[model samples]
Target: MDIDGRKLKILEAIIRDYIETGDPVGSRTISKKYDLGVSSATIRNEMADLEELGLIVQPHTSAGRIPSDKGYRLYVDGMMQRTHIEPEIEEIILKMIKDRVNRIDTLVEETAKLIAMLTNCATIASTPSITQVRIKHLQLVPIDEHSVACVIVTDTNSVKNHIIPTPKAIDFNICNALTHILNESIKGSTLSQISLDKIRVSIEEKMKEYGTIAGSVLEAIDKTLHQEDMPDIYIRGANNILDFEEFNNKEKARELFKVLEEKPYLLQVLDHTPPNTITIRIGEENILTPMKDCSVVTTSYSIGEHTIGNIGIIGPTRMDYGQVVSVLEYVSHHITNMLREMNDS
Candidate 1:
């Protein structure tokens, strides 16, 4: 595809104007606002040629032109100026990670929501499955007469608490013994193999008086360990999607609203993207029906050697590619680094 330098410049001007004003652009507007140094008639001729080449399109017979999907693709892939995140923004993001250091899932969710709010775009983040999480340590705290709290620490340094009620009161010594026994047996095993029956047998053999306590603890561990399959999905600023003037149509707005609420649809969208790379899916390239008018930029975050989750930005096809891409890149890198530190800790 041979795009002349002048034609590329004209297309870039139209894209920039449309993105700024949310209005179909005309040669007069471009010639007036931009230093194209060309007459409106000459610019119009170039726009017509750009349109013929599928780089721009006229929304109506007399309306101004908007960049076609092809034009936006070219601008994003080849012409749009790249942006770097400001130092202040980087500081804020790092501070957020530090504040939520103990909670990796919360860290991911808050980071995505913050970025979405800052950028005025919908943000989605997926953390790695807890099923892949290995247990690092387990501590049992006595909560009350009949209940004990099971605190599980994973290899990722995430702690989860589960409270289990026993049939009767168990003293502190028994609780400590049970905790030691359970940790010794299940610490290195995957969650699925931490069978309650096996735990009961070990407890009965060790201390008959604490059999009931052991059983309850085993139940709690089973519940806590299996909890990893449900990965968290955070969507922030979904309402921002409606702010785009292009989605003023009631039907289009409703369709997008519904899709955003559907977790499976968002996961499918993220899953389609390759791991660990920023993917820019422009309008019509999106597989989802409602997302056809939107664009998505996504990249995965990892913990050391494993990809743990993905984070992405969602906006209109006219989204500022430079800003969105930079934000996603910075956020993804920061999240990965935070996760690695968390695992190390």
Candidate 2:
């Protein structure tokens, strides 16, 4: 049967009702609650068509219909609207983000807590991978004629410094000149983009006459970039998953908690989320087997043009889509703005 405007409206009502009550939606309930002028009998016939079309499913012969994954997909794609967040909640998030935005760990922690409080769902946040971050500038401060301090700042505002002994007695003036030349060559390249061979060739070519400090500079850059303050995953409200009836089965709850506890699993989910927009992974759409019964809403937060990391909400598929979407969007935008302000300051 064709899903015309009428059929779409009926499908939408069923999904919305199921989301609100966490119960199967019947034709009588739809007829009573919605403004559809059709009789209950007429609506029941349409629901049958929707089930036949694989948009909804009947859990039992006597039970009403609940939206199938396909039905929820359609509803989310078209019918769902992000509700306006309360002004007070928005203010609370903005103030907190501005206060903690200077420190990444603090920001991630606060962000996870705020989102969990607002949405009442488990939250996960990841810091930017330093290797993936592009360099903004590299400065060298002369400690003496024999050693210099190399400070590299990434576009994400990550700073790393290393002190290295010069191969020769390079003076402060030479250190400044080398710093300028190094910045010109690799200023915008990510640490991963700066290959050892490429740096050796570039530096040697530029400073061939000055007895190149290429090897020492490359060593310092590598050490600074690989100093191994690994990107941390901050999770808040993992127990919130227990609040859903769908996770009432002990084994199911344990499985989800295991997924949450594993660093690799959390990393996979963060890596899969698209940057700069809200991505909703519903039920079977989730890549992890244990998360098949769960839904995840994710979006990336950025300091500027570069995306630093992602934040996600994990809950049962019956979770409130509109509210979660609004909260994530608000938090992501607020964090981005605060980060930019921090950078500017």
Candidate 3:
């Protein structure tokens, strides 16, 4: 249906009012609140036209109008005003980073929680995976005569530890020598390219007498490398979904809460979002069964050239899209910058 400029303005006003007050917006309310320079009757006629175009719907025969899914799509794609982050909010985010500079995981978790708190919505953050990381250092520290601890540090500066059993007790000096050999052989190689054969060859050539120890160390490294196939997802403020009056329906709210608890489902949802782009999924547009009554705004965060994970905020369908989109944009940009800095340092 074709919409003239006047009808579009009426639709915009109605949507804005409904979003702000969570109530049906009448033609008289728009005429009095916004100086459209038009009579109530003219505005009503325009609203009728917009309703006929499926942009707005009347919840009741005598009630005012609410923006439909098509209307929200138009507003988000064309009419919604873009908002800027406040300087004070930026300062708060910077302070959060400076306080947790030494702990990468803590920084990401806290940042996600803080965003959720600030925006009064559920926030989800995907921790960087191990596959995208290059091996920075690997060490095999002897724990006892029968076991050695494998410590793998990635290019992202995250460290993982594993223990491997040895056939016999080895002295500290011998363990140190074995560690040197392992590092020299595997230090510069990607985890995927490192193999047991290369490690066996290195041990046969250098540490022949302690080949058993070398075998155990290689096994531990293989496990650590494979661990990257599964990524971690962190969610905060899931209970906040209950606070919205829109979700007061017990059955619908329960289903949504159940979906949020499923990490794999959340991961799939986050993964579907485009890289470095802010995507907004409105009600009925969400593919997940339980999320039909909600809206999700998400963007992927990157470390250098590699897009690692996504961060998003979710709320009721009547969410403040303008504010939420602005906040999400700022958060995604800062998160990417922070991850890059962490990698560099």
Candidate 4:
């Protein structure tokens, strides 16, 4: 049977009480705390309907009911109100982004710390694939007559340097001219996006006399950008998992800690979380066995339209979805905005 208004109200009450108190919610508690205008017996009957529909469950033989995973999905989709981050908190995040613009790894770490602090849950932040990072700046400096240092900076502010050996002896003046040509051609292109042959053809056409020198530099840039290392993951507040009652058990805690440390599971979760969207994975929905009883809230961070990485919070199934979701949503968005500006500037 379709849930009536009264049943929906009762289900909402149960879920809210369970999340706040981390205890099974009895019908009497709902009748007393919520103005459902229903008596204890009536509330109990409605709760039974919810449980029978697999919306809630009783942990013990005679205890009050708690929302099932299905119940949480329903509430999150239909009942949870959208929320906004505080203006002061937004300001703080902006300052952090500005301070750490040149060091994206440090920024990711700091962001993970702030998220864990706000949500009081374990937080993991990862870096974007280097191959997808557009070149923000590239510089060539003559080390001597035979060698030049090629420094490439990506949109994420990660810097990679390669030493290039010129076919012919090159001086400072020659390096400056080539640097200008290279920068203009590759200002916003990633290493993977750059075609060595195409760049060589274009550069040689410009510096018709320096064909060999252009090839050497182009090859070095291609090699540098082709190395797509796994994303760097920074985890904070992992210990916070123990704070939840269900995860407090030593066996369960150890299992989860192992998963976090190994990170195979977290990466898998990141693969499923689409960019620019917040995903909530509840119990049993989590891919990792250790995370079966946990709920994860995740969102991706992007520069321009390219998603570089993701950040997430891990907690018990009875987590405060609204609280964690609001923080994740705003932080991810602000990070995207700031990084986009950083890339452009």
Candidate 5:
């Protein structure tokens, strides 16, 4: 059957009511609460039409109806226009970024926490993939006869340290010279852009005897970047999911908690979402089975062509779709701008 304007309005009303009350909405509730200008009989007929269209469903025990996943998909797609975040919320987020966030890791963590606090939903933010960052400074400090400590600072100001064993008779002063040479060659270049073999050959030509030592230290830097290249994911408000009635079941809640606590699974889930778009996944559409009853709104931020980070919020399928989406869209855009400004500065 074709859905007329009346049926569409009724479907929208059902979705709104269920989102507000978390209960099945009866025709009487719709007739009394919404000024649809239709009588109870007309509203009941239209509701039946909605059920026939699979937009709404009736529980076995209740005469009232609730929105199905398809119903919510429709409501968010068209019925609701994009709404701006409130001024108070925008101000809070802006102030937080201006004052508290400096490093990329700290930015992701703070953003996740703020989202969790503002939306009261479980939130996640991923740090920029290490492969996309450029080396800002590479320092080699002597650590006795056998080892030297290699410190790599990225353009984002993230620091990583590694230790490499060297020849027992190696020149301790070799640290200072190699540090200058490595910086000249690799600084301002991304890890992926660095050619370790070419660098080794080139360094050996410049400082023949200590060339191998430079090569050894260079390998340590490479290993450090590759070993920990995975984006560090920050998650917050995991327990917030428990407050929702949908997660009241012990087994269901436990499964979601496990996914949140496991960084690998969360990383995979967020990584698969397309970048630079606001995506909404509802019910069975979720890749995680434990999330079948929940919905996720996600978006990503980037620096130039490289995607720097991703953020998402997880809540019950009956979430306030308009509000969640507005906050997510605004926050992710703000983060993208902030990162570019930081990178340039």
Candidate 6:
């Protein structure tokens, strides 16, 4: 059966109310709270139609109705129009993200935190793969006589620091010379291009005396490049998940937490989203069993040409679709722009 505009409005109101108050919505509440210009009896009839349509359900026969997965799906797919984020809130999000754009990992981490704060939902972020990222500059700073900090700057404006053991005699002057040699040899080359043999040959030819230091640097670079297994996954505001009534059951909440602790599960959740678009997976629609009761809103962010990483928010199925969609879309767009600027500068 086709739902009329009036019925749609009533369903939207119920979803919104349930999202805010975490309770079943009744016709009286809709009549009092929403200016639908309809009487409670009329709303009751419409809600009955909606419940029959399987859009909303009552936990108990005596209780009012709450949005079912079907209802939330309708809201997300058809009813949830793109809404503008308030200027003040947008600015705050952009400012927080801009401050961290100098480094890709930092930017991803901060984006997760900002999304969690703004959405009051659990947020997850994954760092971009550097395998294809070219080295912009390589600097070796002597930490002491026995250690050196290998600072690798990528063309995507990501900065990574790896500390390596070095000869006790190796000082700043020697490190400076090695830095020049390393930069000249590997600058503008992708991480894949800076192979161990290539680095070993280059370093040994130029500074054989500091071969141990060169080996250390090469090890750091290798570790950095082949870091596909550990893609800096970040989680923020996980505690917020408990704030929702859907997760109020201790066993259910513990199960969700246990699944979240598995990095592979989190990776799959974030990776499923395509770049430059938003995806909403409602309860039972989620591939992960533990997340079956939850809704995930995800959007991918890029640094340049590379579809670097994704940020996602996890909340109850009753999540405010319009608000979460707008926040994720805006933040993802801002991150792309800021990162592009970082590269250009």
TM-score of each: 0.82, 0.81, 0.90, 0.88, 0.94, 0.81
Residue-level lDDT tens digits of model 4 in 204-319? 89889899878877877676566645778889999888888988689989998988987667788677888799999999888788998999989999987788899999999888
Per residue, candidate 5 scores C-alpha lDDT tens digits across 1-345 of 357888899998999899888889999999999999999999999888889888889976788999999998888888976667788989999887766456777878998999998888999888877787788898888877898888888776777778878865455466777888788889888888888888888779888987767677777777777888788999998888888888999999998888888988888768866878888998988988888999888888887667767898999988888888888888888877777787788
Off by over 4 Å in 2: 136-153, 159-189, 193-217, 220-224, 227-230
Tens-digit lDDT track for model 3 on 1-345?
567888888888988898888888998899899999999999988888888888899988765989898899888988887677789998998788767645556766887898888778899888767775667787777888788787877655667788878887877788778878777776755666677888788887787887876776677668756866566778898888888888889999989988888988888778878878999988889999899888898888777777766888889877788888888788778777876787687
Report the lDDT of model 6 for residue 247.
92
Better of 4 and 5 by TM-score: 5
Residue 163's lDDT in candidate 2? 88
Best by TM-score: 5
| TM-score of model number 1 | 0.82
Q: How much is the lDDT of residue 245 in candidate 2?
A: 77
Model 6 over residues 1-345: C-alpha lDDT tens digits?
A: 488999999999999899889888999999999999989999999999999999999998765999999999888888877767898997798788877777778878888888899889999998876664678898988787677888887776877778777655678888898888788878877666766777678888888887876887777667755764357789998999998888989999999998778888899998888769999999999998889999999998875667778889999898777888999989889888887787777
The root-mean-square deviation over C-alpha atoms between each candidate and the true structure, in angstroms, is 3.5, 4.0, 2.3, 2.7, 1.9, 3.6
Model 4: residues with Cα > 4 Å off, grouped in runs? 83-87, 142-148, 163-174, 203-217
Which residue pairs does candidate 6 place in steric collision? none
TM-score attained by model 5: 0.94
Q: Write the per-residue lDDT of candidate 1 for residues 42-127, one digit (tens) a residue.
A: 99999889999998998988759999999999998899887887899889988997888577788878988898987789999886
What is the per-residue lDDT of model 2 for residues 1-345, given as tens digits with 9 covering 90 to 100? 347898999998988898788888998999899999999999999998899999999987865998888888887888898889888887898889877776676889889988998887999999877765677899988888778888878765666778888777777777787887778778888777777777677667777855367687778678767874467799999998887778889998998899999988998887787668999998999999999998899999886677888999998887889999999998898888877776666
lDDT of each: 0.83, 0.84, 0.80, 0.85, 0.84, 0.85
**Per model, how many backbone clashes are there?**
0, 0, 1, 1, 0, 0
Error of 6 at 330 (Å): 2.0
